[model samples]
Target chain A: MGRRNDHSRQEIREMALQVAEKIVAKEGLQGLNARKIASAIGYSVGSLYIVFENLDDLILQVNARSLDQLYTVISKTEQQCRQPDACLLALGQAYLEFAMEQPQRWRTVFEYQRTKDAEIPSWYRKKIFRLFKLVEKPLLEFMPTLEPHLCAQTARALWGGVHGICILALTGRLEIVGADSVQNLMELLITNYLAGLKNVQGTPCTPEEGTTQECKA
Target chain B: MGRRNDHSRQEIREMALQVAEKIVAKEGLQGLNARKIASAIGYSVGSLYIVFENLDDLILQVNARSLDQLYTVISKTEQQCRQPDACLLALGQAYLEFAMEQPQRWRTVFEYQRTKDAEIPSWYRKKIFRLFKLVEKPLLEFMPTLEPHLCAQTARALWGGVHGICILALTGRLEIVGADSVQNLMELLITNYLAGLKNVQGTPCTPEEGTTQECKA
Candidate 1:
């Protein structure tokens, strides 16, 4: 296991990310520490810093990879389904399955809190927005004339709901509510939310409900 | 702050919970530890065990109180809104406000993991279910013909979606998506999901889409 001095800096960075992801997968984010990751990758703690800024940096690298994995899963699911509406269902099902299978890894993407002042790089931000765009394409395909801003809002709202369902399922909170199938919750959400979105003739706002700031929002 | 000796058994328990909650409130679950809480309350580590079964039990108590406060907020919001649908919007807004105001405390209710063998007690189960019931009633009141099973499923999905929005907002992930208003996301989710549910003629299923297990689910 001790391959120390054999690996280059980039190689060490890759090894550390793999090891960090494994630690998080096995024991959740609680088990990830600099000492453990450094030792597992057969390097000194100092070497870890030389390759990455800090532990947060290492964690961010791992989470970035996780997001890439999710985008792959969602994009592939989107391609396989014929109808945009059906594609939405498939996308949510893929999301739910991914979270269920690699529950910890999926969660760490959302759960890991970066340090204050450490801005999420533009590249990382694009990866996140790409996931949204994957959802946005099908929504646009499903409804041709929806406002551009409304479409973005819909993508976030829909994906956020799907994300929430997965989080509860992984955390065991859904069990207490007697939600036996994560699939059902996902379907119920997508089915109803889509139908609701379609019911709006033009804009989503109704005149009587214009008092809330969100009516304009 | 140093009322250790003068306090009775119950007072110590209460004191320990208050200190633990304050720690969680400020520093989040990451900052909570037995030594920190015990020391803050002017008690010994051994003394903590005598008062509560363990730290998990103590955290559970704090989470329980948080649930009560949530119930108070939601119940009050429900009373103030006249229509059942308006009540649902108010409930979501209230939930969003509570999470935004006390993010760590609200998050602790979901994020804190109990021990492996720890079966959450019936009282805890009831509290979780009560939150669902509050959402369930409005869903039923809005559409009385919704099947009982369907009503429960709807509540979980809608609330789960709302929850996902809140978690992202608190974690700062929403900022990357350029979502300025949590309330707007909440309203968008509710507005569309409800409209989608109503658009279904009688059952939520179309005849052609009968293959999905959740069609019946």
Candidate 2:
């Protein structure tokens, strides 16, 4: 009886998440209410509380699940390519493809407000590092001499550019630029970013070095 | 009495937009509704309808005004920079800055949905073009050899990348990739995109381009 009850509890939480996703996808986060979700699942409001502490907790669970899914998509893409730059490009493409495919889920992951401030939680931060490590670790092999900080910064720039393209395409604002083929543009962007990495790696340490030396002197 | 009534009509419309902005900023777009807006302005719901056909129409009007304000920001940024590429970079930076500074208004632009999808009216299209022409016209000066269609596609690609970054960064997803300074990343992206324009302008068609002729032969 205990095992069966635990399984049922898990089932109810999954169902609640599905219904919440449906509500957010259709009516957006604003339309999401516990009563509405319970009604959607044909359960009483009290049943929802059994699974989730409150509405905010439910949203955080959904948001975390969505991020995990997004991370999985990027990881799968990275594994398909062996070359450092190719792997990085694949990760960027996958990130773009995921955002375009799941616009509502993508929005939910970003738009949901959590209690955590500027610093993300440790587990979430690990997932983030895992995603970057896929690109950054391979990149170290190709550009063996790059400083860790610069490598991370370049990875971030490329990632930001890809993330930005996905949002623009999904939101329909890309029309302002008169483009249709997101895939081609993304490829070109990744190519350019990779090329720029060579330059950034070779960037003179004069400015950074000067500041530090002046401070010390 | 007729002239006074007309003046009051304009005053009410402006007042409604102000209240709507306040509601959205403080509580998110979900907080905006007729009753709350009317209560905030000390007006009856009927008075709101005098200037707005419905709540959707009111939101649309407010959106139009917001987009106009957004365009004005772009224009000011462009005017401050003389070089075509610099102008594009400045405009993009200003855009990201605006979204970060006023995240609520930025989200309202992306997240708020129109109630109906009729033909896009002329005024709306014009508003869209105003932002585009800032980049399209000046970009043409720099890439004079490229055809119009190609130019539009390239411009859209650049615009899409920048806009996507702003949305993702504002929503906390960019933290996943460890993006530190959005402004510096945007500068690097714009510089790289401008550099790549040379190949698009000067390079002769490669074998892939002449495939139709080769296949016929």
Chain B superposition TM-score per model: 0.91, 0.84
DockQ of 1: 0.58
Best by TM-score: 1
Residue A55 lDDT (model 1): 87
- Candidate 2, residues B38-106: lDDT per residue as tens digits? 777777798889888888877766667777988888788755767676777778878887787778877
Please write out the lDDT profile of model 1 over residues B1-217, one tens digit for every residue.
6565888899899988889989999998889999998888889999999999998998999999999989988788876777777889989888988998999899899988899979989999888889888999989988887878888888898989999998988888788887757777887888788777777635444556542333575
After superposition, the stretches of candidate 2 with alpha carbons farther than 4 Å from their true spots are A1-61, A78-90, A116-119, A135-146, A175-177, A195-217, B1-11, B38-44, B173-177, B199-217
**RMSD (Å) of each candidate, 1 decimal:** 3.0, 5.7
lDDT of 2 at A102: 78
Question: What CAPRI grade goes to candidate 1?
Answer: medium
Best by lDDT: 1
The lowest-lDDT stretch of 10 consecutive residues in candidate 2 chain A is: A208-217
TM-score of 2: 0.75
Report the Cα lDDT for residue B89, model 1.
Answer: 90
Query: Could you give candidate 2's per-residue lDDT for residues A176-199 as a string of tens digits?
Result: 335666776676666545544454
What would the TM-scores of all predictions be? 0.89, 0.75
Candidate 1: the clashing residue pairs are A195-B196, A196-B195, A196-B196
Considering every candidate listed, which one attains the maximal DockQ? 1
**Candidate 1's residue-wise lDDT over A42-146, tens digit each?**
788999999999988888889999999888877898567888878898888888888988888988888888888988889888898888888899899988877
